[model samples]
Target: FVDVLNTMLDDTLPLTPPEWPEWGNPIESAKDFRTILSYSPYDNVAAKDYPAILAMGGLTDPRVTYWEPAKWIARLRATMRGGGPVLLRTNMGAGHGGASGRFNRLDEVAIVYAFALWAVGMAEKAEV
Candidate 1:
């Protein structure tokens, strides 16, 4: 919790002031603290079942570091009370936009489709 909040504060503080309401002024406000805490997926993970989650990340993504999704999956696996798998697929050579070429993009799309089909028990019906 502290690490994620600190990272978010560091990243967003430069673009906006601490008093900025857009992000709930997490630096020095108690009300804002509650607001941010209320909506944080990590902090508010309920002890209930969840659908299969396929989280994708890029090694060089500037906006959302790869570790965020990695940590999210870890937490989901530890806390969630479901059989649905929580998977994380990191693109080792890609950034925020993923692989650059048309064929490479299609490959990424195929992976997503494959995951979706498997999640819905339709993998056998997939033609390719």
Candidate 2:
């Protein structure tokens, strides 16, 4: 949480106008911590059954560090009651947008699509 907050403060905040109410400094709001905690997906996770989750991260993603998803999946695996095949796929050579070439991008998209199909129990139907 701190890392994400710091990133937003240091990286994203500068790009936005300070006077923008919606994008105002997080520390300036008294409800900042509470509000962020309330809506945070990581903080809200509980020991309950979940559908298959396919978390993909890029090595060079500026907006979100790869470890965030890695840690989230770790937590989910540790506490989830059942009903999941939580998976994490880290791209060794990609960034936020993914692989560089057009064909490489298509390959990445195909992988995600295949995961979605398998998650929903449609992998067999997708056979070519």
Candidate 3:
């Protein structure tokens, strides 16, 4: 996000001009830069306990780059003292929504559901 803002501020990125109205020009405005910096997840990493995480990154997701999740997980692992696992699954051949078919999505859902059950000590119940 910071990189994006910098590129946009320099008028290098295509979305800078059109997106200026919505996000403002961070390069020109300190307030805009601060606001963007405040909410950027990549910049706010801390050494604290977090819930079991299942972060998914898409190779083709234009909205959120795949490296974001990978970087986040690495940060979490390095900072977190101990807790439930922080997992990441990259879709090698998919985009933001993962694989295209209903069955494929269900597989993703099943993974999340099973993780949730295990997190709450309900995995056996789910099996039953």
Score every model by TM-score.
0.78, 0.78, 0.76
Q: How many angstroms is residue 12 displaced in model 3 relative to the true structure, after the best TM-score fit?
A: 4.8
Model 1 — which ten-residue stretch has the worst lDDT? 1-10
Q: Give the TM-score comparing model 1 with the true structure, all chains together.
A: 0.78
Model 2 residue 13 lDDT score: 44
What does the lDDT read for residue 111 in candidate 2? 89
* Clash number for candidate 2: 0
Clashes of each: 0, 0, 0
How does candidate 2 score on lDDT?
Answer: 0.71
Clashing pairs in 1: none
State residue 60's C-alpha deviation in candidate 1, in Å: 0.6
Model 1 backbone overlap count:
0
Superior by lDDT: candidate 2 or candidate 3:
3
lDDT of each: 0.74, 0.71, 0.72
Cα deviation in Å at residue 125, candidate 2? 11
Runs in model 3 with CA error above 4 Å?
1-20, 124-128
Model 3, position 126, has a per-residue lDDT of 46
